[model samples]
Target: MFRTVQDFIEDYRDESQNTLKLLNLLTDESLKSANTPGFRSLGHLAWHLVHDDAGMLRRIGLDFKAPPAGAEPPESAAAIAAAYRETAESMLEAASRWSDEKLLESHNMFGRNWQNGLTLLMFVKHEVHHRGQLTVLMRQAGLQTAGVYGPTKEEWEKMGMTAPK
Candidate 1:
């Protein structure tokens, strides 16, 4: 969990950017992909990340605004990516007003009382979880996925190397 607002901000900035890269790579066609018949489509996962962050941050007392729950995914990938960018900036901007102590203060969110720092971390983890799902679905949709932490398999092969297990 974050101890300092700056620490969280720096991490959030990086994570959000990496997430946005994957979002930007999304195509309208690939958005329909899911791991199975009863699973969430890639667009749903992506839009959930964009909208759910608002609720998570608001619960942490950030006063951020994102799309309402159950909002339909935009018809275009660029629109979805743009919304994500806008909301992410708003969330960080609101979080910037918090002091370290405020950030660390415990609060009840999602039926649990935890420090705001942990809640922030949870929000990051939630997005990351869905981001991983989207990457898999993207590959299933015949889209080349970008590597979040290292070179993608395609990139690795291009370099005459293999991906680490």
Candidate 2:
């Protein structure tokens, strides 16, 4: 969990950029890819990633510019990528104002009391979880994905090296 607002902001900056890199690889047509019928499509998940930050941050008393919940994702994947970048910037700005003391304060969240710090941590984890899902769907859609956390198989090959087992 984050003990300082700066730590949270820094982590978000890196993770959000990672997310944006993967999101930019999506095409409008690939948004239709899903693991199964009735499952959430890439479009829905991408849009969720685009807007979930503002919604979660709003719960912690930080408001940012994002589309309303349930808003349709723009038809262009580039637009979705652009919106994610902007909303991430807004979240960083809002979170930067929090103090260590304020982060330690408890609040009722989802029927349970939680420290503001925990909430911010959860926000980062949530982005990571969904971004992982997006990567899987990206592969299913035949798009080359940028690996986060480590180099992908193709990335390793591009460097004329073998990926570790």
Candidate 3:
């Protein structure tokens, strides 16, 4: 959870970049890949991140339009990424206008009250959880996953370096 506006902004920027990097690793074909017959596909996971963030924003009293419903279960990967970027930018801009006291105050979401900081932290965690799934899906699809938190195996090989022990 963030205590200061700067803290949230810095973390958001870093995390959002990581999310984008993961999203970029996905190809149009791989977007349909799923772990099992009835499981959510890669594109569905991407789309969920966008809509979930918007829901979080709404919980905090920020108004943003939800992404349009897609004919496909989760929509195109590109569309999901685009919506995430747009909503994230707008949320950051709104956050800039909030005072420290306001950020720390409690807000009601889903019948429970939580500090704004908690809500923001949950948003980051939610994205990271889905991103982990995407990394696995990318590997299954024979795509090169980026070294998000650290070097991916492919990245290490490309650099002529041994994989970490």
1-165 per-residue lDDT for model 2 (tens digits): 789989998999999999999999999999877889988898888989988634656777877787787788888999999999999999888787777787887777778888889988988999999999999899998998998999999999999999999
What would you estimate as the lDDT of candidate 2? 0.87
Runs in model 2 lying further than 4 Å from the true structure: none
- Regions of candidate 1 where Cα sits further than 4 Å from its true position: none
Clashes of each: 0, 0, 0
Local error of candidate 2 at residue 28 (angstroms): 1.2
Q: Which of the two, 2 or 3, has more TM-score?
A: 2
- For residue 93, model 2's alpha carbon misses the true position, in angstroms, by 0.8
**144 Cα displacement, candidate 3 (Å):** 1.4
Candidate 3 clash pair list: none
Deviation from native of the Cα of residue 40 in model 2, angstroms: 0.8
TM-score to native of every candidate shown: 0.92, 0.95, 0.86
Q: Encode model 1's per-residue lDDT on 99-156: one tens digit a residue.
A: 9998768888868888989988988888888888888888888888888999998989
